[model samples]
Target: MTLRADAAGRERDRERTLAWLRGVSGELASATIKRLEETLPWYGEMPPGRRSAVGMVAQAGISSFISWFEDPRATPWVAADVFGAAPRELLRSVSLQQTLQLIRVVVEVVEDRAKDGDDVLQEAILMYSREVAFASADVYARAAEARGLWDARLEALVVDSILSGEYDDELPSRIAALGWHGHGEVAVLVGTAPRQLEVDTLRRTARHMDADVLIGVQGSRLVVVIGRATPRDDTPDGEEPVSFMTIATALEPSFGEGHLVLGNEVPGVVDASTSAKAALAGFAVARAWRGAPRPALADDLLPERAFAGDPLARTALVQRIYTPLKDSSTELLQTLWCYLDTGRSLEATARELFVHPNTVRYRLRRVADIIGWDATHARDALIVQSALIIGAMSESAATRRRPTRR
Candidate 1:
């Protein structure tokens, strides 16, 4: 049963080979030459092994064509060498003379089939063209790789150029040559993930922010470049200043066992390299936080507010957190402040403000209604109070506003 099955499979293979040979013949006259002509450049450039393969195809095709044209009976088993596979092995079960005779019969049968129909001997000439098509596809894939390599080299050069301070060259064109665009604002974003979630989440967040990002692995570190990073304005009292602490606080929970450092906002290529260096410094801060862990974040590394929580926190309190009520309706805000100062006693708040306890209650409720949250809740109230203090003080510094208190 096994021998019969093997014989049937061989017959099928031979038939398929003949069918391909017939199709190839049809393409020879005009089509085959035109197709191969396009690949000549690439073919000539291919390595010796592949070039030899093409030559072998051409030789076998010539021998087969000659044998078919003259006396098929004189053709040797060596004719199979063109398409590869040893002719002797292919004709192993039969003698060379018997193989020659079989070829004569097969050639006569094919010719008779073509005489009244289409001549397929033309396919032999088309052989290498088909092989060339497959080879050319590979060349195109390699060309894509070359483009990627070119881009990587160009990026390295751009980094060196920037480091050397020739600030006006067309770096974007160099990047684009490697088939990438440095769109929007170019800035550096650095992330340190001691946990796996930190790196992945940061990547997703950067993408959500519509950044052009590139990530690289350096030993145990993951380095990332994010483009178009607008400076985060964290001051909420309508001040134009930036607060790195707020940035850290906002990003900390999502950091998931990693650290986040917001580098300087570098909106253009001229400043991106510098910003990248600064961000690296911020990463140093993140490393330090490993010991202290004070709700730590990288924005804590900023030059001015790096020491925000102690003496500076108390000194800046009046100007930072209280000033928001100065220009607006101070009643509800003042009552809310006094209530906190009086340790949640409405009577104490009323006594301090020379108003009824009911008036303090009404004002506190009004404050909650305006701010969209009931700040009386222990946790939420703390969050609001912190936000107000931070917003007022930080925004004040950002805008160069004179402090209302000291």
Candidate 2:
């Protein structure tokens, strides 16, 4: 009879304490919010809607503690009950450090108010605070992981749009979101994907070299868009800027065993699609040319690309090499045509032109200065010959299209 009476008495005491806690729950929540605004600068500056959500979390935390006191084994559910009251955006805006600070503030308020409560209530408060702290960290870690995945997907989308030569008004905004630092001149590089391609390592390597890249993997190929973040002083004055091929050479080891091609420079990132198209076209036909350099220029593969029916390569050959020479001097064109016809013999070219050998040498030097391609090399001679033939064919087609005199 005596044990029964004691058990009944303890039950009544617990009921009374729970009733008091429930009555003052609103008061406790208000005090916690007030304390948060005063103590936490981040909390004070939160927009009104978010601040209200945080207040709801604090209220729910106080309410959950009362429930947890009834069952000390309910530690696992306390964090969920408290945090679930807040909106999802709260987790994104509030960092783990700020969350821990909030936990500390709420614990202090609860502990101070419950000072005269039973020893079990005080012990429960301490245990609950520890659990909430760890739970807050877990929530924040998951949010960070989710955000990382989202950014990676966005980056991939932007890269895909650039490669496909598709553009809309949102491209600049998307690129800005990726924090692209390149301001001028962009070049695309295509190569075989490495066995273990570590993107972060590639970025670090590019940064060390004072360059930047946007990397993408398409099946067996790895495409990197290279840009100079800042100018380098190593280049001597009066010389052409360092070529993209040099940058490609430095990044060669990052790729798998296969040919690497760098496209011609474009004005800016907005023009990168042109460079990407050229690089991709060259990569498609790169295997046709045996003994291709490890880091080959896309322009160097013009003949192959043209033969593969790449219109850009054909147009580029006509305009860049042939038209420039044709518009510059007829003598230069005739000398080159004759030189190639005679199998690149200076004596034969000079005799055909009725000029001295030195005149032929002077004319060839002038051609080199104008087009930047030396006709003496066997490979360059082939490119020149292909450009001439294509240029003549295009001119003939245009002539036939023109309305003839009646």
- Compare the candidates by TM-score and give the number of the best one: 2
lDDT of 1 by residue, 54-167 (tens): 444444453455444343345433333333532322322333343233233333434444454333334532443343334334434555577567755666566555434464
- Put down candidate 2 lDDT per residue, 70-96, tens digits, no spaces: 776865666688898888888878878
RMSD of each: 15.0, 3.9
lDDT leader: 2
> Stretches of candidate 1 above 4 Å error?
1-130, 159-170, 192-209, 215-220, 229-258, 290-298, 303-406
Q: How many clashes does each candidate structure show, in the order listed? A: 6, 0
Q: What residue pairs clash in candidate 1, if any at all?
A: 24-123, 25-122, 25-123, 185-228, 320-392, 320-393
Worst lDDT run of 10 residues, candidate 2, spans 230-239
- Number of clashing residue pairs, candidate 2: 0
Backbone clash total for model 1 is 6
For each candidate, what TM-score against the reference? Answer: 0.39, 0.84
lDDT of 2 at 137: 79
* Off by more than 4 A, model 2: 1-24, 72-79, 114-123, 207-212, 227-250
